[model samples]
Target: MFKKPLHTLKTSAPLRSSDRRKLKQRVIDAFTLDPELGDALVPEGILTIKFNTHLDEPGVAYLSPEASADPLWFSLGKGSEELIPSVYTLWKRPDLLPFLSTPPAVIPILVGGADLMIPGVVHHPSDLKEGQLVAVCQYTHRSKNGATLSVPLAVGRMAVAGDRIQDGEKGKAVFVLHVWKDFLWDMGGKPQDMPEQRPLAALVDQPESEAAEGDEEIPVDKLTITAQPAYTPAEISTLLQASLLQALSTKIPASAFPLSASVFYETYILLFRPAFPHSVLPPGAGTENSSDIGPGNPQNITIKSSAHKSLTAFLKAMDKAGLLTSKTAPKQNELLVTAVVDERHPSVAAHRGFVTLGEVEARAAKKAVNEEKKREKEEEGGRRVEVRELCKASGRTIGWVEGVGGSPKTLYEPTELRTLLNAYITDKGLVNPREQAYVNVGLDPLLLGAVVTPPKKGVPQKEVEFMKRDEVMKGLLDGMQAWYEVRVGGREVVLKKGALKPIRVEVKMRQGRKACTLVSGFEAFGEGVVDAEEMSEELRKICAGATSVSPRVGGPTGTVEVLVQGKQAKVVVDYLTEKRGVPKKWVEVVDLVGGKK
Candidate 1:
């Protein structure tokens, strides 16, 4: 059910006191947890996040008592009026759920959303009842210390009684619910990659190797071996082209002409991609290149990473190849442009049908991607939104800009605009020979036009002999239109007509001497704009405190102020501006918690 981005995240706040205490009791009761052990496992006082999965299915997760990153014991949905453990939960307490062990070769396929067949099961618990919740794990292995260890990769329910499943049974055994690459696992936050099980795959894929595998104890060391291949843009380009071609021919019909770039790639690309070639290395390189990513799995690869380099380039190449044509479309973001794909080309007969990766091959493709690309993930807040001040020459000054080897039609960055003015003065020897601080603005007609505004009416205009260098540059800048190019969170750089307003944040105490932070004037930043509720949630996450929204006292209609608990002026200022792409100067902060400015 959760194979896509959540339909909704209605409430992301920490669970209330009553709900938190109840959840703690449930964990203790279910696990038979000892008090000392339970204290660390389900830490008291620390926030226990309780939110709905996709807005309805309840989920509970606990952070580490200290220095927690990825959440542990995080699970969604309930069974028997209690929360069932997820694959993540099973990772922490592998023995919590009874398991059905299958060959490691099929574990990859099992996680690909496939129901486990009776034939695939090598070991099954005899007492399992139909519809019993069970963990699906690869065959257990011995650690170097001679201790047995099993890694559960998925969770499912038995489709049939365990006793009914035979070695050659054709019926389904485990009805898969959540797997390693599914949305649930993604929501759990993967702290580590899926563990590889090379030995089991060898025994399962080849009957001849089974006897040898049975006699030898497979060490955990053998399972950790992995393939490392750097996926180059060329191989990935082939996959991208095949996917695009497959999408054009099969996934999206000609009638669906126009779509946003995000829709085309996010929807159609994956629908037809897996069937095409997904290999990074040549054929027969073994299952070492297996990728665990499901077609529904979210990925870091974007259109920009393709061989063609960009969406526009892909379209140009498609047009060149007689595949299809595209019309200019709107941009949803810098990465997602609009597009209208027309597959009515004459050469449509030579179509390559579709691209698909089977359950096993799909993950193989992911592994190849992981090995080759290393995901090229963008770190959170890694790149700040950069705003550049720009200038475009006015009508009379256009020629002056052109004379200085600058583009009059296009905009110039502040430094570029200043450099152009300096070049004109230096080349023409307009700088005062004796007074280097001044420049002769009257030396040339173009220079005079660029360096001076027209005189007001009722007074004859006088040719200025010399002006201070800074004054001349100021006049030149005044002859141009002021513009700002704002790069907001993965969106296209936007050009605004005038200056933007600064967002104001302040910290102060309320009547009871309890501190609260107030944020205002944030609506002025486009795209980086935050609604009160959203700001409240973000603040809650950052500050681990309650937040609320109220009317901005005596402010414009429809405006609201975000109120966060405690003194959080510095963090609010950072989040509202730097994280959202607004420049630092566009935000103002004042702290009055302890009477300090």
Candidate 2:
């Protein structure tokens, strides 16, 4: 999974006198006592620099006390320091510079997280070895006049001995641990390299590793191959030739004396290609020229060669070896392999030992089996969908409920119920004025049942007590009906014994508009069971005025608000209690006079 880059808090703290002195000594020793740097780092001296530390990184970050220095420019790590500043300032002190310089072409790849290969390395310390820390610096020509400078951009561990790297052996050289433009470098909030007028590769010479010859070429014109499979280009070219030769010698029937180039290629692809590392098609694929599709109808698998121009070259090599005879056949669009050379002949038999067909076939078989298993596993995974639980209150749907004990929750726990009650108190401002923490329940069933009602004998329910916080919360939890929610197909569905909250009513007026009555907080009313918009219209007919229904705004609970024209507060209260069977005490009316409610 990909995650967003997070900026961890970087805090500054003053170091104690003793620790400061010791760390200063270590810095001096680490930098080899550079006179200018050593003096400037001293506390309360020519420079008054402050050091800071980051929570996510291990280091003491310090800013340059010089007035001309960029405020964001800082050095990190204990004893060791990597200057997070302009690329131009990297070589300010030549005497203390770390690491041998490298060509500029490798910078982008280093930043992309690929370890440096030995062929890409130009220079390194002779004594550098595995696990040793090294810095990668590149020479950038800043001026058209050919003036160049070196700047350090990355630090990493040596994967191979430095001597081997310097010798230009073929292997991994450096494992990049950190590089410019990584998350750590983002702290400066500026480009780590000089702003490029063109792509970075075009600004420098083409990487030497990409070209067969060490010839100078424009970098942008060629696609550089940073990494290749285990086999080299030359090796793959040879293998293709050998596979064709072996297939012709072993698989062709003696009765088929004269074969066409098309037949040879088809036989090689179907019988020989699967054993190679870079085979394009799966084994047992139907021949491109054939219409039969089942397993019993084995067909030739035609594919382009992995290396450019290798197929033509391989055929020429085979012809020159006299192992096969060929002729141009324009009608079939192929070169004909007219006859098979004698297999018992010394030249043919000598080359025959090179390609171990049995071994390649066995390996290809194992790979095919693994691929089949992977396909089946992926199909099985596609069929599975995660199930979730949802919570419901009143007649309305709340949200999905995460189940406890890895099962969908069917009943609310005492603590969970208390949390809801506490929210209700806060939302309704039901706490007693005399004592802020105590809720004064005035015969409201929701509160009275929870606080006053008791569970059956030995029911393990917390005792309810007035004024006491725990007991009050316990009473609220005990009195409420037990209900839980589960989810189905991305929608929340209330399951078993659901509870509903009371409805809230209010009135308000806008400039140049009549006062409007508002009703909300009826999640227990059940979605789709009651149409708030229709109800509002019906209320308008009864009250003889305009009305509308809208979503409740600026509230913790998501519900609908029903509004009716004029002073319909008394009418709405009456209809809800008398006609709708809603508890009269549950509905609250405010600012009825002058529409301030």
Q: Give all candidates' CA lDDT scores.
A: 0.60, 0.48
Q: Write the per-residue lDDT of candidate 2 for residues 1-597, one digit (tens) a residue.
A: 001132233444445566556656665675565545654454431222333221122343343334432222235445554533322223333223335444455666566545566655544556666766566666432223231335466666688775565332555677665566654454343444553322223224445574434223433223122211344334344555555656655646666755665566545533453333333222322334222211211111122322433345556667887767777777866677777665565554665433233443343334334443563455334322222222322211122122112123345565565566677666666677788767766524345443564457988755433455576665444444456442222334334465444577777775566787788875554431234755676698889888887777886666678878776788988776654445565567776556443
In candidate 2, stretches whose alpha carbon ends up further than 4 angstroms from where it belongs are 1-6, 11-20, 34-36, 41-60, 66-90, 95-97, 112-115, 139-149, 166-172, 177-455, 458-597
Model 1 TM: 0.39
lDDT of 1 at 163: 74
The C-alpha stretches of model 1 lying farther than 4 A from their native spots are 1-378, 403-405, 453-463, 488-493, 508-515, 521-534, 549-561, 574-586, 591-597
RMSD of 1: 27.2
Q: Write the per-residue lDDT of candidate 1 for residues 265-323, one digit (tens) a residue.
A: 55565445542243422322323322321121112123443456666676567656755
What TM-score does structure 2 among the candidates reach?
A: 0.30
